[model samples]
Target: MKRYKKYITPYLSAFVIGPLMMLTEVAGEVMLPKFMSMIINNGVADRNLAYIGKMGALMVLTVLFMAVGGILGAYFSAKASISFTSDMRNDLFQKVQQFSFENIDGYSTGSLVTRLTNDVQQVQNVLMMGLRMALRAPGMFLGALIMAFMMNRQLAVIILIVIPLLLAAIILILKTAFPRFGEMQRRLDRLNSGIQESLTNVRVVKSFVREAHEIEKFSRLNRDLKESSLRALRIVITTMPVMMFAMNVTTLAVVWYGGNIIIAGKMPVGDLTAFTTYIVQILMSLMMLSMVFLQSSRASASMKRINEIFDTEIGLNDDNAKNKDKKVTEGRVEFKNVSFGYSGENGRKDLVLEGISFMAEPGQTIGIIGSTGSGKTSLVQLIPRLYDVTGGEVLVDGVNVKEYSLKHLREGVGMVLQKNVLFSGTIEENLRWGNEDAPMEDVIRFSESAQADPFVKTFKNGYGTEMGQGGVNVSGGQKQRLCIARALLKRPKILILDDSTSAVDTATEAKIRESLYHDLKDTTKIIIAQRISSVQEADQILVLEDGKIIGHGTHEELLKTCETYSEIYTTQIGNQSIGAGEEAAV
Candidate 1:
């Protein structure tokens, strides 16, 4: 919370003024009862019209002040709290953006969304409530208690008895309420996760006719959230009844004792009236404070969740890089005995890629062919430093990948991932993500090279056409080409395509490969493909199996020496004997 001082400092005036204005409202509220008592005991009884009119005018003036103060308090509180949370949310988002793939794996996407939206909102709401009442509640209680004692000390003693009882109840309720609120937030996370998953893959769900299953899952999550919310709220709501009961008992005690005193002509009726009002005020302030506490309990849970984001140490950063100023110049990528695995609990690494070693010189196309889960994607991912190698060093241009700053390193390499993703925007805008300042000429040129230009122009808006979220508006082949076009716009020193052209037809795929080789001769290219034909013309081919490269050579060389490569080639294109003509001549 102390770390939040910077956010508050910017809105310091609002923070200060909000509470002060609330105290002014409290000042008027505490005095209103006294004014009413004066009008009842003095003005009415004395039969003086002038005094009554004057007192009535003062009461009106006091109410006017209270009205002004309350309005100012609410406005400033909202201004300050909203501004505070806005800054906090931005910082939280920035921190999330800094997270490497490994760090992100620690949190669910739904959990992060909840932390940014729901959790930040909870803290903002509580901050607003607290600003309005944090000081006012105590101010009213103290002011009312002082007035009650001044009116009659004996009656005030009854308040002291009920105060402890109310305090005990509030404490007990809060104890149970905090943990329940935490559980409620966790349930909310689950609901959000379920919703996100179902909606994001809604096409799959519909294709498989799993709508009923998804609905059932959502209903269960909804029910769980509802139940948890009720549990948290039920405990907090109990406080209101307990406070009211205490207030009633205390009021009755005051009236009984004060009535006896009045019968003996010991206290004036005006004073008794004021004393009773003060007693209510005191108890009401305590209730207000208790409600603040209850809100804070819920907000505390949210703040804890938010702080988890802030507290997360980003596993990937260039802070300690020796060559932070260095850029990837040549795109000469080399993996030297690299072994990588996702770290599990207690820092255990189950290797996905074992003893991976290769080198791709600038202007060379390296083809990585492997079965599913054979770490083809894993090897290339290390190039962009998406995940650091767990065992050995990955080098680019003779410098260790870790030595280069992430911004410069990633800027030099372009990757079109296995799953092609496009955002909700115009087609041109999505393409511009590769290079924001790229000219329209460059955009069209690259699109042509990726074989996307023709189909893109077929759309009514062409490049200006609005794309659905994740490019749902386009066909799979169109999406793949668009992704490839986007990557080419980067004009990076190194380009990695992880089965990016899988959806395109063989002719179109061949055209794309031809374009890559022709257009990006200076840029190092690494292609991971399922189809053997896709990488048959590559400068070098690495055949992988069971997390190891079992064969490495040119296509013809592999056919002669490598069994795995031959099997893949035979399975894909049929065994066309390269020596059949020579055998026929013999």
Candidate 2:
């Protein structure tokens, strides 16, 4: 409630005025029936044309006033709810942005999307409906009930019996509906996940001829969602008929009992007619109230889910940093007996890298070679504090990396990941992510160093050319080159390339290496690659196997001393010779 005050306080006027306006409609509703009754019982009974004409004019004026009130009520409610939702959505997005990698692992991309969009929509709908009817329905019920009893208490007694029955039915339906709504929302999460995964990888699905498999998978999820929705909605389906039945039965009781009074001359026909209208108003108000409660049940489920996100404990933050003001100035990196792992089921640690220790001085190029799943990427990720070490300390510039704020620590290191990702924007716009205020000359210079400028110039729009989502319009090697260019523009003290150039040819890779060694002579370079040639000239190289470092030396030292390194080098050379011979024969 305290958190929500920020969203509601700014719209306090609309929140108050909306329901107050609805009260005006309630006042007119109660008075109009009496006005109609007067025209019938007084003017028509006495055959007075002037009395009937005056009452008719009053009824017309009351309806016009009610119409104006209803319109204002609706407009204000919508304004308040829409504004509240807009502000809440923005806050929720900011909260998600603050989530650490571990926190994000607790949620899926699609589930977060659902929470930000669908869940907030549910809260908005309830707010809008509640604002309009929260006061109006109860006001109508009380006012109409008072008038009914004043006109004839005998007829109002029948309403008491019908009210309890309707109340019981509504309570039972709501109790059964709440859990079903929760289940339906879970199914919606699964369906959204399926859709997002399929669409994001639609090209891969087609390339592998798995489109049919994906379609069937989607159909299964869709069917499950439909079934869950129907289960939840079946309670609503049962509610409407039950309420209508109770309304009809109550109205019949009023008309039947009141008819006897009118015939016996104990009540006027006009009074009986007015009494029946009040009975309908009372029951209809109950129906409106029931609908509000039903919507509230679903909103409660949504709010519970949203609170989960807000309640999540962010495990990684600089809140306890001993040196929060410290920044990474010199990019000298060292790992001191660092052992890292991810948490698994039952609170167990699944160790990925064990007892790893290394160092790279500023202006040195360190090469890391490993088999698949040997934790090459994991090692470099620690430099940026993307994931913290579980055992020992990682230091940058002789200070613990955890002591630096994440923003400053990451800004000093530039990383190009194995998977290249480009957003939907122009090429120049993408490069600006590295340095938003970079001039055109710097952009072109970095592009040339990355071996991307020649190909980019061939495009009709050059740097202005649009790259489709995820760079789908470009080839794999081009995407990799552009990613390198973006990272190069940052001019960081430490640059880590995690197999970022696997898609490019060996000659182009050599050129890129030469550019880095020549131009960024002072930067610390860490290259993780599979081919030995890629790192043959590196100042030092480390070989990893099964989460442990088995060898460490310069390229020649490793080749002569490390048996594993020697075999890898010999195998790659032999394969290159065989490929050259096959090409000559062709």
Candidate 3:
């Protein structure tokens, strides 16, 4: 919270002025009853119309002032609270932008979304309520109490006696409510996760005829959220009744005692009348205070969740680098005894990639072939400093990757991931995401090289055609090519294709590879592929198995020297050979 002092400091005027105006309302409210008492006992009792008229006018003026104060207080409070939360949300988003892949892996996507949107909103609403009532409640309560005691000490004692019991009930309920609210927030995350999964995969759910199954799963998550929310609210709601009951008993005691006092002439009727109004004001303020506590209990949970993001020390930083001023000038990549693992909150001692070492010369195409879960993506991600190596150093242009700033390092590497994604925009807009200032001629040239230019022109819009979210309007092969075209716009020093062309036909894949070699000869290339034919012509091939490189050499060099590479090549060729033989026999 102290870290957020900068955001709070600017709103100091609003914070102070809002409550001061509220105190003005309290001042008017407290005096109106006393004026009524004066009109009743001194003016009305003496049959003096002049005194009654004057005091009556004063009471109306008091109410007018109170109304103005309340309105001004509300205006300032809302202005301050809304601006505060808006700034806070902006900072939270910036923090998300700074997070490395490792920082993101520690939290679920749904949880992060919930924290940013729902949780931030919860805190904002509560803060608005706080700005309006936080100080006003106590001011009204204390002022009314002082007025009551002055009128009749005995009657005020009754309110004092009931106050402690009401406070105890509220404190007890709050103790239980805070944890329930926390549980409710966790359930909301689950509900969000369910909705995001179901909608994102709606086509699969429909194709598999599992719409009914998804509904059942979503219904369960929704029900859990409902139940937790009800439990938290139920506890908070119970506090109001307890407060009201205490207020009623105190009011009764005041009436019963004040009646005897009036009969004994120990208290005047006007003073007794004023005491009851003060009692309502005092008790009602107490009730308002309890509600604030209840709202705050929930807000506290959300604040904790938000602070978790703010408090996160960026996992990747250049402070410890031996050469902080180093920049990646060339694309020669070398991994020297590198190991990495997905670190969780608990910590990680074992690595997903162990003893990984390799070297790729500038402008060389290095083919990475591996089975599923063999860490092909993990290996290349290190070169871009997406994830830091745990055991050894990754060097680019003879400088350790940690030495280069993240912006400079990442700008030099262009990666088309395993899952090709295009945002919701025109095709040209999506392509320009890699290089916003790239010329139209460059865009067409890269698209032609990716073999996407022909189909793109088939659409009447050409490059201006609108792409749906995730490129759902386009076919898989089209999306892959578009992503490749987008990457080419970067003209990065190093380019990585992690199964990015798997959906394209072999001929198209061959054409794209040819363009990568001949059209972009100066750019170092790394291709991670499942098919041997895809990487057979690479400058060198590295075969990975169970988190280790089992073979490394040119295709011919590996076929003669490496058993792992031979078995993979033979199995594919042998299967195709038998199929060809059977066709000839028929």
Candidate 4:
């Protein structure tokens, strides 16, 4: 509540005005019955036409005021709630953008999406209802109860007994429903995760003919979500029937007790009639109160989830950071006995990269090759401070990476990741992500260097062609080229290609490397590839096994000095030689 004070601060006027306007409705409603009683007992009984007419006009005016109050209350509620959610959603998005990869890994993408969209809506809805009903319901309840007691005290005892019973029931239902609502939200996250995973891997699913399996898996999650939703709402739904029963019982007691009182000459006929109206008002207010409680149960769960994100102290902020305003101009990069792992547990966790020592001089081309799960990707991820080194230090331009601001460090490194992504937009729009101000000539120059220009021009729209979501419209090889071109457009001091060209042919990969060497002569380039041919021409090559660096040298130097490097090169060339002989025979 304290942390969320900022959101309420901007809308304080609306928040105040909405409930105060609703009070006008409450006052009108609570007074109308008393006016009717006066009209009936005095005017109708004594045949006083003047009094009847005067009181009747007052009642009409009150009803009109109530109508105006309701509309105004609704207006303020709308304005306040819409504005609140807008600010909340924007802040949530900015928070996510600032999250380090480590922070992102702490939450699933689907869970975060649910919190941002569905959970926020739950809170928004409750806020709107609270603005309109929070004050009005309680005001009406107390006012009507007081008026009922004034008309006939004995009959009011029924309300005293029944109201407490209903309150107890609401408390009980809410206690059970709160935990159930949290479970239901978790189930919704699971369902969303399933849907996202299935759609993103649709191509693989189709290739394997696994549509039926996917459908079955989805159906199971959907059914779990349905059951969880029903369980939580069943508690909420039960409140309505229990409240209606209490209302009806209270109404019957009022009518029965007041009828006897009037018969005994202890209460007037008109007063008995007014007492019934007050009884109805009291019960209705309780119903509104029960609805408020029910909504609060669900929204309370959402609030906790929302506050969790706000409370998550960003572990990668620039506070207490050295070289906070400094820049990294040179491309030189070094790792000194660097070790990292994904976990942050108290005990020692498995290290993904251990005791790794490496250095790349400015303008050097470094190749990293190893078997799968050999920490090649993880090693480069440390360069951009995506994840901090667990044991030692990573340095760029002779400064510890932790010293430089994240923006400066990342700006100096252009990366085409192992899993590349292009957002939904035109080809030009995606390329401009590296350098938004890049001109047409720069775009063409990089595109040609990436071996992407020829294919791009073949399309009707050329650079303006629309790429569907995640670059779905392009072939794998074409996407690789476009990604390479985008990175080239950045003109970064350090460029990392993490197996980004595996989809292209060996000849095309060779051409890309040639253009990179010629065009980006001063850029420190790191290529992580599985193919020995892809790395053979590099100035330096590293052979990794497990999480350790096992070999390091140039192509000819490694082939003679490192057995692991020699075995890999011999195997790749032997296979290629066999293929060449077979092709010549054919």
> Which has the greatest lDDT?
1
For every model in order, what is the number of clashing pairs?
0, 0, 0, 0
Instruction: Evaluate residue 357 in candidate 2 and report its C-alpha lDDT on the 0 to 100 scale.
Output: 91
List ranges where model 4 is wrong by over 4 Å. 47-50, 344-348
What TM-score fits each model? 0.97, 0.98, 0.96, 0.98
Model 3: lowest-lDDT 10 consecutive positions? 343-352
- Across 224-309, the per-residue lDDT of candidate 2 in tens digits comes to 99999999999989988888888888888888888988889999988888988998899889989888999999989998889888
**Model 1: which residue pairs collide?**
none
Root-mean-square deviation of Cα positions for candidate 2 versus the true structure, in angstroms: 1.3
Error of 4 at 64 (Å): 1.6
Where in model 1 is the C-alpha error above 4 Å? 575-586
342: Cα error in model 1, Å: 0.7
User: What are the runs in model 3 whose C-alpha is more than 4 Å off?
Assistant: 322-325, 575-586
Best of the two (3, 4) by TM-score: 4
Which residue ranges in model 2 land beyond 4 Å of their true spot?
A: none
* Error of model 2, residue 372, in angstroms: 1.0
Q: Local distance difference test, per candidate?
A: 0.93, 0.91, 0.90, 0.91
The digit string of per-residue lDDT tens for model 4 on 237-276 reads 8988998888888888888878888888888788888888
TM value for model 2: 0.98
Could you tell me the lDDT of residue 490 within candidate 3? Answer: 92
